[model samples]
Target: MDDPVSAQRASSVRRSLASIVLGFELIVVFLATLVIFGLSDLPAWVTLGGGALLCLIMVGTLGLLRYNWAYGVGWAVQVVMVATGFLNPAMFFVGALFAGMWTYCMITGSRIDRQNK
Candidate 1:
């Protein structure tokens, strides 16, 4: 029989670590959105609306991390983040940095979960 306690602990650790990383990304992306607002000539509504949408995606992705598809969604989020560079070129660097962090979180978190199990 499988050990429920062990399984639960692993899930807890994975979710906790995943949330931490995604939470940091959420903040960074929000800030980037604000920066885009100020720097880009993109219409005000688009700036605010797009930023709001990105934040929503981040929140959804964070909450849905327990599901396997959430990671796929996260990668899509990363693409959108990087694509923002079309408006603010600096975000290319910022987005890539966060993308790397996200990659690390996924890889390291998975390894930790495996080790714990």
Candidate 2:
């Protein structure tokens, strides 16, 4: 009595739409990472090093930005930089300054999102 073929076509269309949505999300993530990287005064080597560490953290922190542990990991990174004062105290302080601001923004954004929900 009903057309199953048209239903299958509709399902396919939904799948395509979902794929497009996910692709857009990936693009947004890359742009956000770029902005985050751009906002810091980190040196080339420090940026490269931080980039690598961020990649690792992203693997674990994906879809968990609202979690306290995400902020904890960020703070830990800042603390590690602070503790490396022997290497270059200025570098550490500069990085921690940026890191602290970034963490503050992230926390505030999460709070806003929670409140808006």
Candidate 3:
């Protein structure tokens, strides 16, 4: 019989890796909202609304991790993070950094999956 443990590890490497990075990225965005884009700098509604939207995306990504299409949603979230630079310039650098990390995880994770299989 095939080794189930090895098989499961390979499957997880391919999928869950991106989700892990995304979860971290969401937290970073939340912190940046409060620190980099301070409450006094922006309107209360934008700050609260943006924070709420990020929370929703994070939860949705967590709940949808089992599906392949959820990765598409993950990419969309990445773009949103990068776009937030429009409000807080510092996010441009932070977002780009995470985007690179996310890309690396997806590519390397997929390669590991193929190799293990």
The best candidate in terms of lDDT: 1
Which has the higher TM-score value, candidate number 1 or candidate number 2?
A: 1
Predicted candidate 3 versus true structure: per-residue lDDT over 1-117, tens digit per residue: 889875684467856787678778878877877774463478777787887788688788877766778878878877888898888788889889888888898889879877876
Candidate 2: tens digits of C-alpha lDDT, residues 21-101? 333433433443455456656665675565455555544543343344654655554455455444444545655555565
Residue 56 error, candidate 1, Å: 0.7
Q: RMSD of each candidate? A: 2.9, 11.9, 3.3
Ten residues in a row with the worst lDDT in model 1? 5-14
User: How does candidate 1 score on lDDT?
Assistant: 0.83
Off by over 4 Å in 3: 1-11, 36-41
lDDT of 3 at 5: 72
For candidate 1, write residues 3-95 as lDDT tens digits: 987567547665777788779888988898788888888898999899989899889888787787888888898898889888988989988
Q: Against the hidden true structure, what lDDT does model 2 obtain?
A: 0.48
lDDT of 3: 0.78
Better of 1 and 2 by lDDT: 1
> Top model by TM-score, which number?
1
Superposition error at 36 for model 1 (Å): 0.9
Give the 10-residue window scoring lowest on summed lDDT in candidate 3: 32-41
Give the residue spans of candidate 2 off by over 4 A. Answer: 1-68
